[model samples]
Target: MAQLMTIARPYAEAVFALSQEANSLAAWSEELANLATISQDPAMAAMIKNPAYSADQIVSVFTEVMGENLTKEGKGLLSAMAGNKRLSALSDVSEVFETLKAEAEKRVRATVISARKTTVEQKKKLSAALNAKFDAEVEITYEEDASLVGGIKIKVGDWAIDGSAQSQLNKLGAAIAQ
Candidate 1:
């Protein structure tokens, strides 16, 4: 995972800079996402790893599968990625690029899991809390997990706050056993 991030960083930065320059962030974002999905397919992976298939073959298959309606610039980017043998990293690049773009737009995603269905007010308050904590524009998604029993679990990026009753019970159980 670390190596994938390392390999994807430069590509993400370069694409982001180009998007800023061209003011076509949306187009590029969609194109990269589609390309990433294509590159991640098992058949594509086999093709990329197979010594029998040439780079041109890979590119040809990608172009054909991607259809004929793509912009010339998008095709050019795909060709460049294929030529450089970076197709396998396309998904990683796309993911990191989306994160970069979201950061640029002052948007963050937060996952909130609660014991039961939450009201609109609850979601709004949670979003407000997360926005206040991170000082960023937050988009919160809510989920109901009955196993949690009570309280909530909030995750933002790599950070998680597990205040779920089940979690505390498990911890207490471990402590008692020890």
Candidate 2:
């Protein structure tokens, strides 16, 4: 997984630079998402790996499947990936592109896992707090996990704040056992 991400990073960065210059970040985002979806399909995966299909043929099939949704730049990306036999990296490329897009837009995605569903007021407050903490706009997604027992666990990017009753108990247990 890490190696694939490393391999995909350059492609994602190149696309990001191009999109920035073209002022088509959103369009490129959608295009990368669609390409990743198509490339990750099990049938498409098999076809991509098969030696029977030439690179041009695979690109044609991909472009045909995309229909009018594909742009000229999208076709170029597909052709390059096909030529390089890097179609399998599409998922990672999409992920990296989204990360870059989020950073560029000054937005962060946060997940709040709680024992129960959060109220609208709670969500709003949490969102505000996260925005202040990150100095960026926060997009919150709430999830329920009864195993948390109480409180909430907030995850944003590489950081996590674990404030659940289960976590406290585990910490207490470890301290006592030591």
Candidate 3:
């Protein structure tokens, strides 16, 4: 995983820089996301990994699948990846690019898992709190897990706050066992 990121870093940084220069961050984001999706498809992965297909063939398949949605710059990226045999790194490149974009845009994505659906008011309050904490705009998504028993678990990037009853109970159980 780390090696993949390391291999993908230069590609991602180059794309990010190009997008910044062109003032097309959103467009590049969409392009990279689409390319990543296509490259990550099981069938496509098989094709990309197989030695039977030439670089031109791989580029042709990607170009056809992407159709008119792909921009000229995106096509160039595909050609470069194909030539470098780095098509498999598209997913990592997309992830790293998104991280760069989010940092530049001063935005953070958060996920909240709760025992039940959260009310709109609760979500708004949580968003506000996260915004205040991160000093950036917060985009939150919510999921419900009944096994949580109660309370909530919030994850923002590498940081996680697990306040779920199930988590607390597990910790208590471990302590008691010790």
> Residues 52-91, candidate 1, lDDT per residue (tens digit)?
8877888888788878656677677667777777778888
**In what order do the candidates fall by lDDT, top score first?**
3, 2, 1
Sorted by TM-score (best first), the order is: 2, 3, 1
lDDT of 2 at 131: 97
Off by over 4 Å in 2: none
- Put down candidate 2 lDDT per residue, 34-129, tens digits, no spaces: 999999899999999998999899899889999999998889888888899888899999999999999999999999999999998998899889
Task: Quote model 2's TM-score.
Answer: 0.93
- The global C-alpha lDDT for each of the candidates, from Candidate 1 onward, is 0.86, 0.93, 0.95
Per-model TM-score on C-alpha atoms: 0.84, 0.93, 0.86
Best by lDDT: 3
Tens-place lDDT per residue, model 3, 1-178, is: 8888998899999999999999999999999999999999999999999999999999999999999999888889889988999999999999999999998999999999999999999998999999999999989999999999999999999999999999999999999999
- Candidate closer to the true structure by lDDT (higher is better), 1 or 2: 2
For model 2, the local distance difference test gives: 0.93
**Could you tell me which 10 consecutive residues in candidate 1 have the lowest summed lDDT?**
68-77
Runs with alpha carbons beyond 4 Å of true place in candidate 1: 67-73, 174-178
Candidate 1, residue 127: Cα displacement in angstroms equals 1.4
